[model samples]
Target: MIGKHLFSVEAKHEFVRLPHFGPFLTATAAGQAVDSLLARFDGLSIRMHVLASNQPDGVEAKEQECAYQLECACSEKSPLSVVEPLARAGDLPCAEEALRIANDHGVKACEIGYLKVDEGFLLLHVHMVTADLQKAMTATRWRRRELLGRPEKGEVVIMTTPIPMLANS
Candidate 1:
């Protein structure tokens, strides 16, 4: 299941500042940055959401609220260089391509983030309406491979639901 606590205090601030640093080229780079935040802050809560740059205005508004709800304290921004090597390796799809595929598959938004607090395995949370669940799941499966590059055996968790439905749950 997707954790209700998606971001640590530090991670929230980092995400809020990510845009100023520049666009993350790939999900792997973003994930690596998230991992770094967790390590640096001893963050127990962390999550990564992948959404299209051109989302509808309504969706964008809700996302801003969501970010606010997940706020935390940290001023240092993660350097893009930490993850640039993996991003330049060319093994994963660029953020734009991944977002395009997800949008085409009816995924309103998706998240790749840490799962168990102690285990440190990754979890993928796919958000979409019930009508789009199937296609969204397929897109999420593709994303799993892209983000994790063969996730550790028995360490994968996939969760799905509409974002509104997840707000209080």
Candidate 2:
């Protein structure tokens, strides 16, 4: 389970409608897309969200906060400030695609969640939301493996030292 303390950043989103991806993407394609997109940000990692405030309904017009995990890759590094510019970059196709999808769905706003501490990453409940979440998550996971190297599986393993503390002291 991902500890709640892991999410130290509460990103603010300013959007007007919903955004969606094109046809469902294969894991390889999704990973490549995210890798290409991340280069724009100099390979910094971050979590981003795109939300659509519930539309007006009933006489009182109560506002309901709708949470959506927009189809995008993320990392347990970098800040929203760093990720936002790349997202808003004029020549970025991913950002434009995001806007186009949101326009098509009539989204309300977008939020970009980022990491505030240097901690081992955890995959959130992106699975509960959309297939796109998996696509993006898989892409980021693969990317992480590519850069940091993955642990090899073995029948027997040795723990030569005490477990280190994961949280701040």
Candidate 3:
């Protein structure tokens, strides 16, 4: 919940095709950015879509509609953008190696999630979705520790406070 409303990214296989971390995060981040954009441009009527109009890609101009949409992904939302991450930057991408890269980068310390609003900063959800549901459970423990730093006994409610860094900086 980073903005005035819940805007969403309608991902095609192109974005969520897995193993490719930067693309996945960038695509997902784009959705999150759009949601935030909606909040910023609340009064205007925005016609939004995934920006796919060409076989190689057709959503070029629409990517620039917002400030946070990341220049790279928006510029080449078509076939050319496939090789790299346009917005969100992280450890190098592997062919469907998002989980491995994430773990290596520091799973216990940080995992990515969709951005949510927190204080004056944005939020993120970095859980890896797997058919092995048990694996997803770690997000709980990791989030608790990273956010609250090990609550003492009897501690129940936890709140998150994000420290803002420029997007993709």
Candidate 4:
């Protein structure tokens, strides 16, 4: 079994209400006010629900170009900041074959979020959570290194320890 640490990170940002239109709603004073609530958030949030082991099957040749997908294993909960580095990785297909492949690889759902400060869009918050905690931590460390443009000493906090699994009879 995998560890439950589920690494995560978060930062704060200055926010301004932006206009939005939903299927059953339009931009209005009340809507803008509601949008302003997002200002309370420093950055957008995202979660990885399914990690596909392989692409969906039965895709026609004509659809193959569109099939070059990756972020399907992920879910985005808010609009991304223009300056944010991480983008939608794509979503996992609902096809049975895809699900089977994901299962074979022991894939599990995960989540990510961002935070930026009000000044010049400096990212103030960023967070990621996954059953694959090592991969997530590596990515976070890489991001920090990129921001600093050099190698830096750092450590990821392990929130939970993994339980030892007994051998199967």
In terms of lDDT, model 1 sits at 0.33
Q: Could you tell me how far off, in angstroms, the CA of residue 143 lies in candidate 3 after the best superposition?
A: 3.8
Measured with C-alpha atoms, the lDDT of residue 112 in candidate 4 is 21
lDDT of 2 at 67: 13
What's the lDDT for candidate 2?
Answer: 0.25
Tens digits of per-residue lDDT, candidate 4, 22-48, equal 111112322333343334333534221
Candidate achieving higher TM-score, 1 or 2:
1
TM-score each candidate. Answer: 0.22, 0.17, 0.18, 0.19
Q: Which segments of candidate 1 are over 4 A away from where they belong?
A: 1-23, 55-169
lDDT of 2 by residue, 58-88 (tens): 3122111111122221322311111111122
Q: Could you tell me how far off, in angstroms, the CA of residue 68 lies in candidate 4 after the best superposition?
A: 27
Judge candidate 4 against the unseen true structure and give its global Cα lDDT, from 0 to 1.
0.28
Any runs in candidate 3 off by more than 4 Å, and if so which? 1-92, 105-125, 128-146, 150-169
Local distance difference test, each candidate: 0.33, 0.25, 0.30, 0.28
Scanning candidate 1 in windows of ten residues, the lowest lDDT window is 78-87
Residue 94 lDDT in model 2?
43
- The top-ranked prediction according to lDDT is 1
Segments in model 2 whose C-alpha atoms lie over 4 Å from true places: 1-62, 65-133, 147-169
- Give the clash count for model 4: 22
RMSD of each: 17.7, 21.7, 16.0, 18.9
Q: Between the candidate structures 2 and 4, which one is better when assessed by TM-score?
A: 4
Worst 10 contiguous positions by lDDT, candidate 3: 78-87
Question: Which is the better candidate, 1 or 3, if ranked by TM-score?
Answer: 1
